[model samples]
Target: MDETASPVESADCRAISEVLSRVGDKWTMQVVVTLSDGPRRFNDLKRRVEGISQQMLTRTLKALERDGMVKRTVCATTPPQVEYDLTALGRSLAEPARRLAQWVRGHLGIIHANRRQYDSRR
Candidate 1:
């Protein structure tokens, strides 16, 4: 650890960094928010999340499922059906995620302005 870094602070930073690494993905948050509404079949989720490819959606869903943030169910019909919903733990993240989304939308203009100013400065 660096001299400036305490063990407790380093641990907290590592944990926060790990979480952000997981949820910091663009599609992850969108997928979570979509599932927050209700359980959805794979195709429906793909459609609702616009711009995500079949493979990308599949990968993101699988990762979320692996993280215990989402549950996957398969129906036993002739044409098998699959649906995904957030686990209780996953659902608990919705409010903070929603607030983050809202904050981004709210500040995008300012962000763009800052980016332009920074770019011009460089």
Candidate 2:
């Protein structure tokens, strides 16, 4: 067998890979960014993360909670309310997430042009 090293094949960075499996997902990334500002009720979060299905939101939040990146709290009220917020661990990802958003904003034009160029040849 060949022993070439892949970025995620290393034992030391395995934890990061697992984390990425959650945060790297599209919906999770949006949810994290939305909650970065503050806690949001379930419906409010759903509204902020446009196009996300209810099932997908539930699943993503559940996975984030399982990973210790999100905290869920149920409010005591007439109808009851549930909110989600980033935990300390989740807050740690804020800078990286912001950087990622910035990178996308900075590179989107270039990426779109590149895609157009590539598509012209096809």
Candidate 3:
């Protein structure tokens, strides 16, 4: 906490940090973007996400569900098919996530150049 910051501001910062930690995770934005298309089963999501392991996907889905950003439904069938989709809150995050990804893609060249320059200097 900064000396000049009030308690309310510190609390707000903490809350924001916690949420950011969830949304800023390596796989979170990717998962959110994939789900934006529509609901998908576990294996389908795993395939579309690319490079994500079954365990990691499971964890990510669980975390997203816990955060109210994802909805998980189980179909009452022979084997009980499970599907995951973005909730309203998750949908709200999709546009911003896409924009952020676009910004990163657009800036990759400059960002890489900066990183190279910084590394060379070091």
Query: What TM-score goes with each of the models?
Result: 0.88, 0.86, 0.95
lDDT of 1 by residue, 71-93 (tens): 99999988999999999978988
Write model 3 residue lDDT over 51-105, tens digit each, in one string. Answer: 9999999999999999999999999999999999999999999999999999999
For every candidate in turn, the CA RMSD to the true structure comes to 2.0, 2.9, 0.9
Per-prediction tally of clashes: 0, 0, 0
Could you give candidate 2's per-residue lDDT for residues 1-120 as a string of tens digits? 126767556754677777777778999889988999999999999999999999999999999999898999999987998989999998888669889999999999999999999999
Candidate 3: stretches off by over 4 Å: none
| Better by lDDT, candidate 3 or 1 | 3
- Model 2 sits at a Cα RMSD from the real structure of 2.9
lDDT of 3: 0.97
As a whole number from 0 to 100, the lDDT of residue 6 in candidate 1 is 89
Position 26, candidate 1: lDDT? 93
Alpha-carbon RMSD, candidate 1: 2.0
Q: Which candidate, 1 or 2, would have the higher TM-score against the true structure? A: 1
